[model samples]
Target: MEQLIQAIILGIIEGLTEFLPVSSTGHLILAGEWLGFVGESSKTFKIVIQLGAVLAVLVLYWSRFVSLAKDMLAWRFFRKGHLDALHIALALLPAVVLGFLLHGLIKQHLFGPEPVLYSLVAGGILMIIAERTKRRVTAEEMDDLSYRQALGIGCFQCLALWPGFSRSGSTISGGLLLGTSQKAAAEFTFIISVPIMLGASLLDLYESRDVLSSSDLPVFLVGLAASFIVAMLAVVTFINLIKRLRLTWFALYRFVLAAVFYFFVLM
Candidate 1:
């Protein structure tokens, strides 16, 4: 029962932080440390539960995904469209490659409180600087983004290989720095996340298959369901919030959270 409760809490944390500029993995690591949830099963749980958040994205953007599928079947996806599949692919390429290369090393060494603490602070500073130095918006909409801009964002996403740097934070801030509007960057962050996270979740599940068991099924299910529900709400709220506000707020939150974690959790 206690494990189940921990799962629910972790699920809520995952959903709340997944799409936000604040790092989801960073939060999970810190939360797990505090909750005494460290182990292979906990690690596997964190990765697998991300599927719930991915499902929320799918449900919210079902029509867009369906349109992309139809365009792919008709081979019109390359011509022109709002959700350019090619651009997303371009944006995902760098991270996919780097993630593949660094997967084992990251899991073995960097998936801990110390690395996350430093990364959270450093990423927050970068986000603040990026927002302050943002240029005139050239890509006002996700579809307006050129392949070059998408590639640049992908390159920025490489920074997120560090656990606390945050995939959305790096990509969206990179987009802003590269002249994409905030709303456009946030939408693209959500859209491109489906493939990247789905792929990563699958890889983690497969690699950690030994951690799966009938006894733990309920815990996994409860966590997955909780994350899905919360993520749906979070995604919608974040999109609306980004339309009216800057990402500096999230950066500030990250800075404060890092300090709290360092003093309370790490110390």
Candidate 2:
């Protein structure tokens, strides 16, 4: 009962931040460290429970997803239908490739807090630069985009494979840099995250098969539920916020959080 309770709490934390520009990985690492949930099962729990949040994306955006599929199947969408969905797939390709190629190395060494610490700092700096550039020019919103822009965004996504750097942060920042409106960049970032997260979680499940057992499976399920519920709210909130807010706010938070982790926790 005691262990189960701890697992449940950890699961909730994982779900809530997984999609937000705020680093879910960083929060999970810190949560485990502070709460004494850091154990053999920690990494697997973190990865697999992400399914919960991923489902939230699917559930909340089901209409857009369905429209996308219908349009693509008929091969008629675009001006007639919404094809931003296809662009999302195009954007996810780079992360999928890099994730697969570096599978073993990333899984073995990069999923922990210390690695994320550096990522938080470096990624924060990158966010500052992205924000500055975005501020210089009013981002333009195009109803449709060229494949080249999507591909460029996808390439930027590859930078997110490093544990601490966020897939949302990189892609959103990329969109801003390339002259996409905040809303468009954020929407694309959210859509692109679904596949990237799904692929990673499935891979982790395969790798962690040896450690699975019936006894603790329910904990993973609970965490999934918690994360999904929380992430739905988080995603909606994020979409609404970014339209009027600058990315610098997140950069400031990351810098402060990193410093706290360094002096208070690490020391």
Candidate 3:
């Protein structure tokens, strides 16, 4: 019963933070600490709930995703739609390569409260810097994104391999710095996130299979359902409101969250 409750709570946290500049992994770690849910299985649970959020993105962008998939399958490499597919792939490449290389090291060293808190603070500062120094918004929409810009954004996304340095935060900041507008950056961020996050979740599920049991299935299902439902709402709200929102505001929130966790939780 207690475990189920913790699962639901963590699921909500995952849903709320997954698409935002806030780090879902960081929040899950902190919440797990508070709820006494730390373990290999707990880590696995975090990754699994993230898939629920990824599912929300898929459902929300079903037509676009389907079109991208068709473009990929047909190898229509030079078509505009295929180019968009390539852009997402380029934006995912750097992180995917680096993450694959450093996966074990990152898991061993950075998946904890102390590292996460430091990353949260550092990521917040970076986001502010990106906003302040960003170039003029030349790319007003995702279709305006160039291959070079997409690759550059991917390089920035590598920062997210560090826990609490959020994937969305890194990518959106990268997009801003590369002259993309807020809405374009956010839409690109959301679209690009689906493949990588979904892949990572599946990989983690396979690797952590030894730790999970049939007994954990119900808890996992509950978390998955809660995360999916809440994530639908969160993503819709963000999309509707992002035009008027600023990354600096989210950055400030990250700063406060880090400080609070440091003083109250870590200390």
Candidate 1 residue lDDT tens string, 1-267: 999999999999999999999999999999999999998888878877888999999999999888888888887757453667788889999999999988889888888899998889888888888889949888998888888889999999888889899988998889989999988888888888898889988898788777677887898899899999999999999999888877788888988998998888777
Best by lDDT: 1
lDDT at 158, model 3: 95
Tell me the whole-model lDDT of each prediction, alpha carbons only. Answer: 0.88, 0.75, 0.87
TM-score (C-alpha) between model 1 and the true structure: 0.96
TM-score per candidate, chains pooled = 0.96, 0.90, 0.96
The list of candidate 3 runs beyond 4 A from truth reads 81-83
Candidate 2 deviant stretches above 4 angstroms: 75-81, 84-86, 134-143
What digit string (tens of lDDT, one per residue) describes model 3 on residues 167-258? 98998888889998877878888888888888888888898888899999999999999999999999989877778888889989998998
Winner on lDDT (1 vs 2): 1
Model 1 residue runs over 4 Å out of place are: none
Q: In candidate 1, which residue pairs get closer than 3 Å at backbone N, Cα or C atoms, i.e. clash?
A: none
Better of 1 and 2 by TM-score: 1
